[model samples]
Target: MLPQDLITEILLRLPVKSLLRFKCVSKQWLSLISDTHFRHHHRHASSGVILCRRTDIIHHVSLAGSNSDYQPFTSLCFIDDSAGVKILQSSHGLLLCCSNYKLGKARSYYICNPSTKKYSILPEPDYVSVSDNSSVYLVFNPTKSLHYRVACVRMCSSSFNSYQVEIYSSETRDWRSSGSPFAAPFDMVFDSGVLWNAAIHRISPTGASLCFDINQERLGAMPGLPSNEKWSRRRLRYFGESGGRLHLIEIYGCSTQFQVFEMDMDYSSWVPRYNVDIAPVVDTFPEMLRNCIVRNDFVLYAFSLLCLQEDEDDSLLLLHIPGQFVSYSLRNRTFKVLNSISTESNNAFQIGCFHAYQFMETLADADQYL
Candidate 1:
């Protein structure tokens, strides 16, 4: 038998694909991978960079790790049409994804570890019906036994103008309805298995926008926008976590000036953090970016625009919004652009339903590593 440290050392070096397959190697290994300590270690070793796709093929990009040269790490392909998935959110080493197509009444949400290839199809949501229009969020809670939870909010725009919330637990394979009712005003986004809890940008007597918390499976008020600032409901684009804080990125319409703010833990306040300028990118590409941001603890992967360059026909340049993916040190108010990223690929890759983890070399860094 391998020594515990030896086994861990070997396991840390293995890619996520191999690790997932090896979960059945032995109960000890299974327990190790499931353990919080090991998970933290795995999350750190995988940080600072990410694997992305430009066209149909998947390739690796350096986001914050040792490979600053922008080297291609791997090439991946789907087995068939059904194999293509769109990543909605990533947490730990696992990814939350759903099939790209809108198949009538077909449940598509799945939790998978792309590195290990271990996937669990979430039990068919109880509240999703052919007639009811509802939105869903998927959450992974470490404090709650590492089980996956799904929350769905449905709006009844009829006479009552009411909404309902329900949660599904993977461990129990059951769905339970929450006691409270909410009013659906705007759409919601989930991070690491909790609703992002957005501020109510618009207010109407009959309807109001609200934020939903995935972990608690409850509804709460969204924190207000920055005070004494000219703001519009549309300019306020809610981004997931960045730099260990719940973040929001607001742009001034194709203009270079933009703002980044962090949401307080109480879900009641907003603190202005940084102002960004994307004017430099306009010279390279004529059009603005249509990108989504996702995070794993301290690092945020800003999925920006995909452009076809004049010289490179088959290749595309991924324009990442700066400051979206950086390391934040609150004590010093200093942030660092991750060094373990690939600069060779002028364009970043699109994250279609993919997952990435931090590459950790030690223990202290692993705390909240995901």
Candidate 2:
């Protein structure tokens, strides 16, 4: 038998799937694999992407390997039989999901680690008003602490153009109100907040954005893109965090050529990182070109930026065309098909039909701090 320290070093290099199966070798191996420190080390060693379909099915896609298998998680059935559930956001290795609102049942929220097949139901927030709209985002950094937090942004019911923030801590296992109500644009939506730089960033449809610091419990305005007359009516193609960096892509006037900008650490300005022109990709896959007439002259194509992966050599951009996912290389300017969607289902796999979420496999326990 090998030394215990040597065994641990070898085990850390293994993938989460193999580590899970190796737990059955012996009780000692099981205990070692389940150790909090072991799991934290393993999490930093592996990373992947997960696509959340319109039907609420989560599919895992490997990032470093050629295996693009879709693993459906049927073990996520924790709520009542009648209520349906959908994922709201994903951070680190944890997922934030909520029960679909039904006529008689009160809505519930959940934080789960699908890799371990473990989940915990979160208690409802204190203020639940029928008239107010609320959005909850997941905040977790396994490297910092074992516990996670859920930040809720809800519109104030009594005051117009005012919003309140509430935080739920896994360590305390309870919800508490954060700072006082702050004013923001009435049309600013908080449903799609992205976690980056220890803060939750949200961009509104009208180009307004805000950032809420998790540690300081403060909200402030996020710097906008550089001003340009030509890009005045640009649409936000993508806004997400990848590899500890925040990226934003905006497309203007039905053009395939655009620039991907990376925000600075100080939130000062956005610097252009990648100049992408997917005209070749659209030409290769002609079916992806769905022309929409805008004001009878301009034409718009159908495509969605799924993910942006940063690496030392070449960064990759994941895009969704009607039924397929394509990977574009930023350095080489090459394109490859990552995965194809099946048309067997009733739902059409179009641009707006599905959403993508980054999934990193880890042994982070759902009930560790609870």
Candidate 3:
């Protein structure tokens, strides 16, 4: 028989799909794979991106190499048949989803691991009213703890400028209000909340960006890009966390050239990290260029930034063109097609818009929380 350490070393090198099947091989094998430490190490071995379509279908695209494949995964149909499920957020390996709002039925929220097909329906929050608009963000870091947390930000019923935050901890298996109601702009949107630096960071084009510290339970202002009259009419191209850093991408008008900013650790300012120009890509793939005349000025809406991968030698920017997924290297000004979309999905992608979530495969058990 192989030594225990040798067995674990071999198992850690295997992909998640094979490791999941090996879990049923023997009692001892199952114990080793289910170990928290082993699961944590295995999660870092592979990573991918989950693309959520407007119709609620999910497509998984691996990021393990420069050229990866895309496969149709699931629509989360098993959670609830009567209710339509939509993925709201993705933190680490877990996903935060909610049901469509029906006239008579209350909305249902769920945290699920699509890899393991394990899910838990969250209990209804106490502070939310029917009239209030609420957005829930997931905060889970297996490195910090095995437990996860869900933070809900809702507008106060009494004041338009006041917002309240509530947190649900899997360890406690219950919900609790975090801090007191705080003041924010009435038009601030919480839909783009990204978990980083132990807080949920949300950006707004018209107003000041905000961040809510999960540990301290306090709301504070997040630094925004430097002012520029040319970029006044801000179009948020991308705002997400990648490679353990918060990144923001905003475009002024119809230009393909832009700068990608990375937030400093102190949360004081944004540093210009990468300069991106997709004109070459548009020239190569003419189908991506969509030109329209607005007020006698030509406006071009060509591509969307799906994700930014930060690596020591091979930093990449993933993009969604008309009918394909492309990876553009930041270090070297070159691009390659990762995968292609079907005819039906290409048409849908053009009309409906782009929604992407980073997916990290893990063996973290969700049964304990349930």
The ten-residue window of minimal lDDT in model 3 covers 291-300
What would the TM-scores of all predictions be? 0.61, 0.91, 0.91
What lDDT does model 1 reach?
A: 0.46
lDDT by residue for model 3 over 63-167, one digit each (tens)? 435225524245677676366878888777888888776778777788887777778888776655423278788888888888988888888778877888888
- Alpha carbon lDDT of each predicted model: 0.46, 0.76, 0.75
Tens digits of per-residue lDDT for model 2, 1-370: 9999999999987766788899999999999998888887784444556766532455665554455553524235554335777788878788888877788777777788877777877777665632226888888888888788888888887888888888889989878888888987656777878889778888877777888887888987778775463444667878999879999998877688999998999898889988899999989888766544364345567778888878675688888776677888887888887655445431444576767777777678876766
Any residue pairs clashing in model 3, and if so which?
Answer: none
- Rank candidates by lDDT, best first: 2, 3, 1
Candidate 3 global lDDT: 0.75
lDDT of 1 by residue, 3-80 (tens): 999999888775554566788988998898777667555633333334444323334443322445533223323312
Rank candidates, TM-score, best first: 3, 2, 1
Evaluate model 1: give its TM-score. 0.61
Off-target runs (Cα >4 Å) in candidate 1 are: 1-3, 6-10, 17-41, 48-60, 65-84, 102-107, 126-132, 157-161, 186-209, 214-217, 227-234, 253-255, 277-370
List runs of model 3 lying over 4 Å from the truth.
54-56, 63-72, 126-132, 230-232, 290-298
* RMSD (Å) of each candidate, 1 decimal: 10.0, 2.6, 2.5
